[model samples]
Target: MLLHVSPARVGFFRAQLDTGRSGLVLCGPKSLQQARRLRNTEHFSGPLLVDPAVYEVRAASGEEPFPDVAEGTFGFEDPLAVSLAEQRAVGVTAPMTPTGYLHAEDSDALKAAVRRVAALDDPQVVFAAPVDVGWLREEDSVRQLIACLRLVRGPKALMLGGQRDPLAQHPRAVDHLRQIVTEVPGAALLRTDLAAFGALAAGAAFTAFGAGSRLRHIVAPGERAEKSKGFAQSPHVLFPELMDFFLGKTLADRFAGTAAPVCGCAACEGIRALDSFASNAGDRQARAAAHNVAVLMEWLRTLTALDSGPARQWWWYERCVAAVAQYPLLNAQLLQPNGFKVPAQLKRWALAAPAAVTVQPRADAKDYGRS
Candidate 1:
């Protein structure tokens, strides 16, 4: 499985390449434009995919072609952006969950949203996450979500999206996805955002975790709004699993060192000490982001190397479940299969919405809010 990590900015691409992890996703013109300058007009070799910013599909109301885009044109129309995407990207995607998560039972609603994406002639990938699937307590709901994926054909990548931060959305998300591609011949499951690496063991062809704190966590599809203020830089350290963010310079320093939990990614492994990651300026934030990706890369490499057999994917599924369940730190972030119940508010859409799931908190993190 290829673990594609996002660049925190155009500047971090080299750090990733220097580490030998490729297929860096250019978030858009914004990230791409800057990357170009940083490279001094150099070209990136691995497959580049453009996130067309269409993750949300319109709801069950009147269906239209990407209703969320301004003036009905996806920003991909920017001549410069289009040229760059076409020149560099393996493909471009319409947001898989443009209308947000759909109830597992709401097949009609899902078809309405997915039809346009399936019909597109451009090299495309389906980027969707079943709504409210995290709190899923019933097995039938899982079957229904798999059915929705089974319906999609002629696809490039089956990217799983829409889970909020720090919570395992649908515990069976990776399993069902593994089953889908096994039965369907065209596409491979590509999971993104929180817990994506875990999905890799469950059979993701490619998986990505957020490169920065801002990109790491997401509002549950149902709860997100149209607008929000940009986040200011803060002193924070990315923990293992990329779920929880511990905010504070002291905490960052304490956890970052050869003796600490930090991984030996290409970027930070060379840094001599954690104290060097002081929180005085953007340097701290950049280092933190690089460190997060580095550790994530190292972690993924380990998973990929665990088994070489045909059953390798299942090798991960079993390994991660047993491994995380015992490790207090991992359990603090992710959930074990059939582990816990989700919040009442989050569970409201579990069986009813077009997409949904719910999960309980780890023993130590009972105070964490379920998004």
Candidate 2:
């Protein structure tokens, strides 16, 4: 799928996106206009925008923003906004990010609002899980996610959330979320938080990270507003290439003896290994970005071409799971010892860090994905 990793703003970005893929994810703050523009670009058949409320959470520690909406739900927009997004072939993704509780009443109010957002019948509406919730609270988040999923029962209705278990640091979240994706019937897409991409090998589903690393390769978070000229400030900074590399490597290594093909895209077609491309900063960064995108597209194409058979199932259960399980061990390789690439390294660090255990594992690990 054609995935446009962009910030949440509509007016900020002006880049030419690659659109041959099947889907697009607009990361960052939510913007109806930006969503429409993405749809107009044809890079994605249907674009999914991560909600703005994720950044509004107010910390008890007394951060700058008192009433933090960082973990808040998207109740500000009306159904018209969602409809407008549809006009541009983009979809709206709302729901909580799962952070600290503001108030019991407010939480309930937010839950009610989520239900209302899901109730809207539009061509593009995906109710993703709250991004702010702690992984230790997966049960609560899952319960809330289930409620939102129930309201949006159409074929387009998809579910999304960050991870909470096993590889909660890296690829484990993918496997954990995969259980939800597999079990959550009718789920069209899934999303991973900034930290989970490296070892996870997650898919066309929602993926977000810092902006500088992907589009402009911004070094400092403070430079986002000033330096982000032709790009959105949202999660577009975090492109899908992070996870794509993991998945592509897994596919190449696991199914090595089989007909599993290497990506024919410009990046991997004539290349031997990922290291063949110049991945260093400056001129090298662009080359790495190009190769990363190409490799990702190739993986998605192969995945899309696969038949819905036992092999696919086995792939998800075995290789996919194994890759995620390896997140903790493979994390060091995700980083470069060199400086100037700090931003990307930080994001990878988040994905590889261990998460506290909270949710009770189901009887069978397979139950995680059984619909």
Candidate 3:
């Protein structure tokens, strides 16, 4: 499991690191300063990925500006220079090559970015592509991406970023990810949510979810900004049993009940109902985010403990099936029929075929050079 670090929740993430449960920690351009502190600490020895977040630059220049892209955050015209410098400053030994969201039709741009990264001479370089989500819907595009990825000659990893929530929107997103990972080997889904679990079951090396809802998906360029409607932003609390997140206010208003489920994660200890997370008490948001991470990490541990690929896939399928089953029970508990809309990704996960075992041994990074 990969945890995307947010600057505000650095302390919470630091606490998580103390548990030694972290796999890969991803930090964005804005969080690099905090990530530097984490990297210099004794507790966090795991690999840290400092994402240049080139997609934000693309978004800011598009029809609808991404609100999150603060002016002058990525001041440089070339994101690669900024990316390499940031990684170096943070002491990332093997930095990822930063690239913007590639349109499927722009094969030349895709090939150029791939070749550019490959030429960087980093033996363990990661080729990161922030792609348009539509790529998954086009077979020719998927094939084009896979073919380009195969051209990397040395030890490398692939990090895929998509515009919006592809797993929820695209019917075959999971299968397409499986196919890509099968051909590309070391691939990770970036800026995703619970769908990352589906990618894991589909044979991805690991996947990342941001600490907050806004960071969960890449909002498409030209998309209108959502109106706040005078309500303060609330934390998105994950209900692990249901494999989904609920806004804190929504949980309190609708799901709070004597029979409401409780989380057993360390962060949630002593909390009677998950709805209690809705309270805006001191550190509630941070604590709630911690609970989300803890529960997901626990599930990751359970999945990884299984002996074979088929066993892991079966376990994931069963988990999805069980989560889906809870929708009706939750509706019944709330006395509101059809309160919860089952996520399409969750349903697809339940019906997914067992993945074939194709774990490949990673080549040692003997030399940080592009072959």
RMSD of each predicted structure:
9.9, 11.5, 7.4
- TM per candidate comes to 0.61, 0.49, 0.83
Residues 91-185, model 2: lDDT tens digits: 34332222222221234534554554455554244443333223314455545554444555442222222222112334333434444444454
Candidates in order have lDDT scores of 0.43, 0.36, 0.64
Indicate the residue-level lDDT of 265 in model 3: 74
Ranking the candidates on TM-score from highest down gives: 3, 1, 2
Instruction: Supply the global lDDT for candidate 2.
Output: 0.36
**Candidate 3 lDDT over residue span 156-257, tens digit each:** 343444443556567876777778876776676766777677667667766776766656766554554353332255667787778888777777767655
lDDT of candidate 1 over 38-143, digit per residue (tens): 3344555544444433433333322432334434566546422343344343332232323433443555656665565455433444434434444233557555
Better of 1 and 2 by TM-score: 1
Clashing pairs in 3: 121-370, 123-368, 123-369
The segments of candidate 3 whose C-alpha lies over 4 angstroms from its true place after superposition are 17-30, 41-43, 59-82, 153-164, 222-233, 279-281, 355-371
**lDDT of model 3 at residue 299?**
73
Provide backbone clash counts, one per model. 28, 46, 3
